[model samples]
Target: MAYLQQAPAWFLWLASLGALYVSAFLPRLLVYLTHCLRRPEDLRLRYGTWAVVTGPTSGIGRSVALELARRGLNLVLVDLDAANLHEVSGTIMSRHAVQTMAVVFDLSLVSTRKGDEALRRLRDAVKKLDVGILVNNAGIAKPGAVFLHEADVEAWVRMIRVNLWAVTEVTAAVLPGMLRRGRGAIVNMGSASSEGINSFPLHTMYSATKRYVAQFSRSLYVEYKSKGIDVQCQAPFFVSTTMASGFAAAWRSSALVPTADTYARAAVGWIGKGSPLCVPNLRHRLLGWYLAAVPGGVQDWFCLRENLRHRKMLRSARSPRASACRPHGHGIPSIE
Candidate 1:
């Protein structure tokens, strides 16, 4: 009876501790659980399939291509780098003994009338194959501080062309066949910035393009998920590929930096499990959850502060000599 009477004080303290622990660890635990429950059977590929992987010359795209080839899928490797595309195709064919076709065209420029013609040619090339998978991984990021008047206008347009426009075009090109066959998988490579507008500084254009990807993926998932077409959007954080090595090295955090191969494996694994959106690294997954739970105003403030900090760091890193000697010519944005 005495113990019961005194229990309220102890119980309150224990409850407070429980709440704190949950606040800190529940999201991570849930993400881990979600991954655990996701089985390969939930998202299995039919044997002897054909897949089209864009930007297969390097980075995550190359890793994805190798993964698909290893899974016994015939591949159509698409990239602007003809030499690298041929080399990669040859390597995959010799190593995996899988049929591979190389399609060399700049997907980023596939917007003009000539670009449309090129897309038609590429489409025709793949039309003969039994393409069951479409991996829209081609993307580009411009190096700039912000989407302001100082930024290169053409660079912004090119970023949109590669990151957003190409994804839409390729997905549309592959849709009819997938719908007709009543079985296909489309994995769009989104980024962590898509969840929030101000996820990174100097990434304004890239972030906006990714936001489009996230929205498009959600809408398509709702419209076609029941039609036997699996549409997934993978929003991964920084991977230690050449594409992101500079950023990763500047930050120098291994836990936050996953390798391209690790990212590819987790992404492909989740695709096989039919996950609509996959964020691989545990820390990023938690950050995403926290960002989701927070208010929009708070997120905006956070982003603004982060941008200011990045700007300060960037200013400190630039030397007067290098700044004076920097080239004035406009350069095209490239994902690789």
Candidate 2:
């Protein structure tokens, strides 16, 4: 203290500026460290006996479901593919020694009262279980760049139905039970595209829907934090999974693009803590900070260029010449 008081004024001013700069990221760094150091919560004790995950057949959802099971929580796994859903549930049951229920229904089927029926079925299935954690992880993205006016009408609408409507309806269905019980956590899967980029031109609808998820989750958190519910919107840059397999080779896991399992483990630790909007990966958090410092026009140009490059690669892969060289009957399933 005596040494600090004797320090030159110029040095003190510089030290204060450095401290302020570092303070911006200190909280997030502490959160990451705390997650790593602490033992994870017993889901059964912290939330409830059963946790529900949508899109649990593959990718991030499957990883999170397995993690929850490992934490001793029974699962309600929802997916459109009955076979895949059963397969995932069976694996979790066998390895984790936890019970799992597979609910097979298409979230994008919003015609002829099908969407209503699907939600009713989902609500009924979940209501039977003491669901404590809900992960709204189901979403769809258009594969390439096409102007909104040029895109297929049916496919675009289907993206909206699955990405936005499913999240809202499923949350509505499960939230009442949580309110009555007075304890639960909700994790809404989002994307870094919602944060870093100025505009995701190729993935316009998907980006817009994710923005909605972030905003909705924040508002929900404000409304429910005192009521024993934790809501988080997690926006990750990338994960090496089937949904991201096309770009997997190009973008490997780091602190930025963590493997699905790694990300799931980290994400579960923040279930009932931190700000409502979370970018779980350290690299993504740093990147978001950097992007925010960039001028808006520069961010816009970068996003446009990056998405256009992705579009070119997708088009080339789907070209007739390229398709002829691939296996005769195999195709990447459209489910994810």
Candidate 3:
């Protein structure tokens, strides 16, 4: 204290600036640290007994469905591939003490006239169940990154349809039931390519769609939090999955890329937390903190370089399916 009183004015100002910087991120740091110690109310009890998870056959959706089931929520698994959906349902039923229903629906068709029957089927399926949780985890991207003008127009349309339209429609179908029950948790999947950086260069359309998800989740959160609905947008850096397999091996290393199951384990903990947005994986949150601190120009520059590198890697890849992004209908089936 005496030393501080004697300290020069300049030193004190510098110290104050440093303290402010540290304080800016301290709350986030604490939340990330106490996550393990904090025990949220049982989701099944707080929300309801049944949960609906879209794109539940693979990747983050599959893992999240399993995690929710472990916590005693019955699963309604939605997807386009009937075989895969049924297989996932059986896997969940056998591995965990939870009932499972497989709903085959094409997410990419949500915005078209043909989507009406599919949405009606999904609505009908969940109407009788106590649908307490909704995970809109299904999404897609164009096959590799390309300039907007260089790509076929349909590529952009498909991404918007599945990523944005599908999420919107599925939530609409599930929300009425939650409103009637007066409680639920809605988790919309997001991508770091959209939120963590300033601009995602080559994957423009894909990132733009995800940006819509983030806004949609935030708006719903404010609108429904008082009514007992918790809306959260959870974004992550690349996870090691078939969707990202086209990236360079070094960038996709296990240390940098979490597996889908690893991410899902962390995700379930934040279902009904106070925050409207989250990067559930601890590793991801740490990286996100650093990214947030960096200047936007620097981030955009590096993001462009990394995306371009991935594009070249995908083109040169020997595999027929070398794209980091999936082809149409290649997206994991989920609610539409």
Candidate 4:
């Protein structure tokens, strides 16, 4: 009592502020570390017997499908490419000995009745299964960076349709069943572009769409978490796939730029854990933590400069002079 009475006011204020900071940040840090230490549970028991993965033919989607199969869950593989979907289904079945079904539906056409029809088909395909997980992984970004006014209107619209609308529509279609079953998980693929304080200048629409996913996922989490549903939006950067090949050539294989398979192996362990908004890739999450320390304006400028450099390099590579330098047997890589 005597020591407390003699304590300095400034020291008490500082101690209070320190406690306030810890109260705000410590729980999240503990959750993240817990998610890191434990592997995801058995999907068949945790959610259900089946999991659906959209855009399952390639990239992270394909890897997620395979990883889910490895965990002994039947799969419903959805993609626009029927041939590719079939191949992925066959591979998963043969490798994991799990039943697999492929649903070919184009998410980019959601603005029209075409997308509606595709969703109908997807619903019908999964109507008989005990689907417990939906991975909204199908999304697209244009080839080269451009200002909003100069961008391809049709492509930009398609990007919005696929990245934003599809997520909403798909979740709506799938959520009722999850609610009925009393257990389910929805994993929306967001981007690190809008994670934390980073702002992508030239990639405006894509960033906006991802921001929508993050918000939607968090809101849905609050709404349905008590009903035995897990909705999460994971933001990852520079995944080494056809979609990101335009950003950096070395993205082919690097610790910072993980291949889809490698990223998925780590990401799957986080499926039904952590905050509704997640950065699944460990390296990318660490980078996000580092970037959080920098001033917001500086982060924006760095992203803007990087995007500009990438756009210039892409333009040069597509120019006639650079095209002529290619070897006879070589061809430009598909940027997806």
lDDT of each: 0.73, 0.80, 0.84, 0.83
lDDT of 3 by residue, 125-213 (tens): 99999999999999886644566788788877888888998999999999999999899999999988788978888778888999999
> For residues 1-336, could you state the per-residue lDDT of candidate 2 as single tens digits?
999999999999999977886788687688777766777667788789999899988788889999998889899888888899879988998898889888777888844387778778888988777899999998877543655776788888888888887888889899999998999999999887776667777677778888989898999999998989999999887787766644323334454577889888878877876789887766777777767657889877866776677667667767898889878887743313
Task: Check candidate 3 and list the clashing pairs.
Answer: 55-334, 79-333
lDDT, candidate 1, at 222: 82
Report how far residue 304 has shifted in candidate 4, in Å: 1.5
Give each model a TM-score: 0.81, 0.87, 0.87, 0.88
Backbone clash total, candidate 3? 2
lDDT of 4 at 202: 72
Model 1 TM: 0.81
Candidate 4 has its poorest 10 consecutive residues by lDDT at: 246-255
Candidate 3: 10-residue stretch with minimal lDDT: 327-336
Better of 2 and 4 by TM-score: 4
What stretches of model 2 exceed 4 Å from their correct place? 1-20, 110-112, 246-255, 324-336
What is candidate 4's lDDT per residue for 206-273, written digit by digit as tens?
A: 88999999999999999999999999999998788888865534323475788889899877878987
- Arrange candidates by lDDT, highest first: which order? 3, 4, 2, 1
lDDT of 2: 0.80
Sorted on TM-score, best first, the list reads 4, 3, 2, 1
Count of backbone clashes, every candidate in sequence:
0, 0, 2, 0
